[model samples]
Target: MKISAAGPDVDMIRVDAERLHNMVSGHAFYSELPKDVRGKIGKRKAPHYLRSQEERNVASSINHDYYNSATMFLSQYVHTLPFALSQLSLTHAGDSGALQLVSMPLQYSMPFMAKAIAGIETLWPDMRLEMPEDVRNLADTWDLLAEQGVKGVGT
Candidate 1:
């Protein structure tokens, strides 16, 4: 992935997977886990372990150092694709052709958005998911219309 800026003041962007892994692994979020349990878990363990174990008990406790190290290594391998897709979506947000392609398929987009929201909730349960009041109003209106057997605008 590459990004170019308009001036000499803007340095070239570079992403080192190893460096990013090391940085993320060093963050307080990953570092604070108990070390003993991390060693027992396999490489294929779920990312929900990224969340603090204090929130919910796993069948076994994680080894903190192993969890952090393994998470760092795994994140290096796993995060690239989703990060690239997110960058692409942001880059294309203002392109009319791209917007039209995404917008023309509202049914598919709606479920995708819902799933993304659910994933966000799973990843950060304490975070609030906010939508504009107008969007909320529109959803309420659509639900009412659906209940009344009137498939009105944009349904």
Candidate 2:
């Protein structure tokens, strides 16, 4: 969602269009596909949003870092059981330790969610949408909570 909102500023549509054309024209793998399929894929264009060249720059650099951090943490800690298990330090061999292990990662999602909400709030006008005042208030509340850190709150 955040990336799509940042697409216009980053020339993502143009890049993706070029990539699609290259897949059909430059790659032998796509050459093996049916002509109609290749043509359909090649002709497809990403939807555009109006923005001046001056306005388009690396406006989403921070979001990119957030995305990379989330991806790396999830891959190593949450997605794979063995990697997750290797990082665990359980003080007790009971349900409390097991629950604590699971909740730690889940609690880490608060900041990511807060960032997503902030991105949505920032992009709402460009999207021709009105974010309710209550949502903004809720996001502020979430941001405050996220700043307090995730330790000693669960399990």
Candidate 3:
């Protein structure tokens, strides 16, 4: 997914993909791959050495404009470098390498929650799921903050 800002090489990507496919085919699958080339990913489906095909078929089915932008905005930091690197905190300070604890700014949590709330609001319009007043109020506040570009909380 990361195609450095400069640009991505089409041939290199194709080659890399083909190599990866060969590797997976040669040593990854338990038996022959299923005829329906859809999915059954994650490490549980593979041996320890290979990578999991982390996917989201439902997310793929969504309107890309809204879902992708929001996901990409948050995805880079969850476990990725730079963002993860920024979370290091000194839990202990001593000559023998200080113990570090990963800590990130709490501000990131709200936007994800707000987006989730938006999803819930959309899906629960029929009122099958009763949303609490406080949660609704909080979502409203988040929406307002986003609208005003307060803390870059919204789209």
Q: In lDDT terms, which candidate is top?
A: 2
lDDT: worst 10-residue window of model 1: 54-63
Residue range 53-82, candidate 2, lDDT tens digits: 223323432233434454566777646667
Model 3 ranges with Cα > 4 A deviation: 1-83, 91-106, 151-155
> TM-scores for all candidates?
0.22, 0.35, 0.32
Ranking by TM-score: 2, 3, 1
lDDT of 2 at 149: 33
What candidate 2 gets wrong by more than 4 Å, as runs, is 1-58, 61-69, 77-81, 87-95, 125-155
User: Regarding TM-score, does 2 or 3 come out ahead?
Assistant: 2
Model 2 RMSD, rounded to 1 decimal:
14.4
- Give the whole-model CA lDDT for all candidates, comma-separated: 0.46, 0.56, 0.49
| Per-residue lDDT over 58-109 for candidate 1, one digit per residue giving the tens place of the 0 to 100 score | 2222233433443453454357667435645665656866765444335323
Clashing pairs in 1: 34-64, 35-63, 35-64, 36-63, 37-61, 37-62, 37-63, 38-62, 38-63
Off by over 4 Å in 1: 1-102, 137-155
Candidate 3 lDDT, 60-115, residue by residue in tens: 22233334444554566665757534543433455344332322223434544565
Model 2, position 125, has a per-residue lDDT of 48
